[model samples]
Target: MAKSLQARKSELSDQEMQLKILSGGAFETGELPTFKAQLSKHKIQTLRPKTFSILQLNIGYMCNQVCSHCHVDAGPDRKEMMTRKTMEECLNVMKEFTIETVDLTGGAPEMHPDFEWFVEQIRLTGVSEIIVRSNLTIILANKKYHQLPGFFAKHSVHVISSLPFYKKNKTDSQRGKGVFDTSITAIKMLNKVGYGQANSNLKLDLVYNPSGAFLPSDQVALERDFKKALKTDFDIDFNQLFTITNLPISRFLDYLIASENYEEYMQSLVDAFNPTAAEDVMCTNTLSVSWEGKIFDCDFNQMLGLKSAVKNPHISQLNQNELMQRELQLSQHCYGCTAGAGSSCQGSIA
Candidate 1:
């Protein structure tokens, strides 16, 4: 195992060199090969026929911020929100499938005009779990939405916020300056609403991606640091810390290619492949849905615009039996999931 980790690091070292040279060796710690390699492992390709869960619903593609590593490539440019009629179709389909969970995603899923109506309808279904991937800052984006924390609490929805880091500087660099402050505030709000408190029925999960470019430090260790820091200063408490690996797709892929970090990152992933993590990958359960109502095994495939080649690729026209029987799409980026400790939307798969 030690030798394998070393080999993986060495492979990343080569990519790190290229990435550094691309910017005249100005690459920061986040741009390092080790981190890039870590991000590359989680392919998130789903096994349809064996799927244990279904990720239904897409609010649309409209966001308040466009981060450097955003896989969605979302911004003011995206105008493809799910129409009310389309959402009704989704709800109709939902009644037919025994989907254990509903994972709602988008540029800013809440930005969709019909987002509330959709969520309310889903609430009626009372699925086992409801997950909403939020940017944190959005909850406090405006007066109307400022009360979202309360709404989420009322519906007993699980909240997943992308904080990037507990530190101000690193978070600002990847997301945007001042984003750290807003995110922190948002967390505190959720904490007030009982989202992150221990033993609280409301489940609150915080997501951590690499800052510069190194695989995340130990998840247990990082969680400790965040707990200590947020508690002492911000008085915020949260549940599990999910250490996700970034995938080489969309904006991040462009960053790597333009900065010449592509080959190195790819090589690093191939070397660090871990067999154990691959077996328990998120694709075993979760099904990712895209902005235009498209379906993928996971979010990574959605970033690359890789659609299901299965019998029923589009979620609107799903064929459960056939989709279940089809083989998943494969790509070089899959190494990210099999690397040391592995990675997935839920954090370290290993």
Candidate 2:
């Protein structure tokens, strides 16, 4: 039997192994051009910040379900979580900067003991929008979480839940068994509180991640299909659908290697490279803060252990001017963001 990736951690740190895989193999052999090379070909010298509008905080890695394609490699057994100290530091940054949006994410961000407190604190910061990236089922995962929809509505939190596909078989295959049904139930609960309603201030959006090793189809088309199917089948409604590309990293990277799709996928991204998309990549305006308070250019880079190229790389030491001036850290995985219509937390850029 083959050893698990965790089993080889003693031989090489997980981050180190991922970095080696990204830097060597086809990349070193010149079968694929480095991300920097691709940018240079388009006369783009450096990827820099245009603004600091969104501050995405990944609060923890403890989750209920072990999805097949989780880039964070988050699961029930993982214990890494953000301490109140880190959360406080994050709040400080929000107070200091003109952050327009505060994005909260995790294995299940609600799993954190301080989750509610942190949300309340963020609301106090006067940030215009507060987004919680939830995995729908979590709202029904436990008796304690049953009132989450009400709580979210009370706070006017923007809920962005993941539903890989409208069909059960597809969603279950990628997420877990019974996830689609549970997610539907969770959506109903959210809807009961006025979320996803027409002209409702309470916003509830669905996120669609391609179930396979491929780029997502056009966002507008996918949104149309989702709205039609969901409304017809379950009488559900959502404000918008965000289609996010799964970058090669962590569990998804393992899948690409195990299924022998790494090379083909990389080539496809290269083939579909869009200069317009590259220019609008999310990293230019978003700053990703890891659970440990380490700052990164984006969440993908956070998982890859790529810190922002600023001198002050932690939340406590945040230097807004320096962070805005530093160039973005790049790697082969960046191609995932620049391919075709372009993928970001907000979905299709081009």
Candidate 3:
């Protein structure tokens, strides 16, 4: 019987284990071309930042639920949280730089003690967009969180919640039992607060991740089906649906290995590699900040403990010119982003 990597933390908590698995095996044996080689084949010498528009912060790693597909592997037992001082460093960087968007993520970013204060501070920075990646069920998880809908509306924060599927069974299977119902209720609360309402500016979007070791279907088609189904069945309304591919890392990687689907899934990604998608990968435009303020090319890289390929790779010491010039840190997991239509926090990029 297999268990989660975290469950066997004593045995496999080392980040190197995951990295070794990704870099070794087929990748090491030449069964699959390395990401660098693939890029060279397409004349992409190096993947570097094109802009510094989005600052995505992973505030903490504590969550109320442990979703099987969660790349963060966030759960209640995880205690890694960002300190207020570190957040202050982040704020300083925000004030120093012209950030267009501030995206908050975590086990559940809201679980952080000073999450609201952090948002208020970001607002003070005059960032044009503030995106909170909520898990949906968290909005209804506790009595204190019951007012999250109104709170989000007050700040005009863009709420991007995860809803793996419109149906209850599929959703619950990926998350947990009754998560779909709670999420639906939470959506209604957001709708009541003017979020996702027709013609309303309080934007509310839902994310869709494939429940298994497969790439997500067409974003447009999935969004259409989601809108029609949610509207007809529960009168739910949301701005749009973002279909994201599950990168092989963290808990999802555990699932792949445990289920003997690792090689097959990696092959699928390689087969569907799109150079256009590779060109537009999120790492090219977004900077990921870990809970402790370390910088990475993207959130997935942050999870793998891969810091940015620049000197002094910390938010406190962020240098716009240096970051723009830094080449991306790549691995087999990157194939997930370039596969098919390409996946990013904002859904398909190509």
Candidate 4:
């Protein structure tokens, strides 16, 4: 019986492993390393990262489209969502901190029923900057969201939209088919509202992540190529290009196992660990809040169900004095944050 079961297990294929990882959960196999160990190997501190002047908030975990590589694994099925009441609590807490920036993110942040209202409320505050990380295609996913560019314009939001790559094949391969076209259309609309052009008050930034198994190329070089290619081939215009690394998490982990690239990707990241990037990690300056009003050290940990240190736990029960004194959680996956030139939502952290 033991031999028979062993034989059956040996017959399991890559696709089989992927299905198990995807449906039952990635941890079912226990093959992947923990988030903290990965960070420690790279000499990156997985500890209480300092709170800087900026704050990056995850408004909710619910999103309309389920992309193939979404680190958060956000989609229509997700029930852990943020409510208006909780958002009000976040707003209340916002008043206690001297933060100059409030960044809102989500499955599709704009999909939040009160997304516009939240934006308006944040706008009313004297925060010096507002950054919205958007999946460009979401802007044209439906008619109701058609006027998003104008809304962003009104708020003067610093738009960081993901394009994966300028080529249709690459972008669609990672995100989804037809995503490239929709994203292009959204950019055109943003350009009309002064998004990417030089000297344009509307700040439009493009985010690029490699399609597979590697860290992103240099930012300045990639940005130049993107600008020239978009202008010549697609007649598109945008501001700075941000290069981000695709984190190993959620659906992406499933992809790695399915494609037989898990080991390769992990080893690649470990090989390219960059010390300079460690000094300016996003978590050092930004605080991340989950959909249910829980505080996290960073967005990555929030996705992994890691909560803030003891002094501050639940956002709903936030105490500014307590939060200011607490330490942070750390993990192995943080290697992705400091590898190579380093990666954050706004490109290289170093």
List candidate 3 segments past 4 Å from native: 1-4, 10-12
lDDT of 2 by residue, 1-350 (tens): 22223534532228878888888877899888899999999999899999999999999988888887888878776788999999999999999999999999988999999999999999999999999999989999999999999989988999999999999999999888899999999999999899999968999999999898899999999999999999999999999999988888888888888899988988888898999999999999999999999999999899889999988799999887898899999999999899999999998899
What's the CA RMSD of model 2 in angstroms? 2.1
- Please give the lDDT score at residue 212 for candidate 2: 83
- lDDT tens digits, residue span 116-182, model 4: 8998888776788889989887788789999999999998998988888888999988777788888
Instruction: Using TM-score as the measure, name the better of candidate 1 and candidate 2.
Output: 2
TM-score: the better of candidates 3 and 4: 3
What does candidate 1's lDDT look like per residue over 189-281, in tens digits? 888888988868998899999864455657889899888998898888899899987676556665676687766766666567676776667
Q: What order do candidates take by TM-score, descending?
A: 3, 2, 4, 1
The collision pairs in model 3 are none
Using TM-score as the measure, the top candidate is: 3
Judged by whole-model lDDT over C-alpha atoms, candidate 3 comes out at 0.91
Q: Least lDDT summed over 10 consecutive residues: which range in candidate 4?
A: 1-10
Query: TM-score for model 1?
Result: 0.84
Where model 4 places Cα greater than 4 Å from the true spot, the runs are: 1-46, 319-325
What are the runs in model 2 whose C-alpha is more than 4 Å off?
1-13
Tens digits of per-residue lDDT for model 3 on 85-105?
Answer: 999999998899888999999
TM-score of each: 0.84, 0.97, 0.98, 0.86
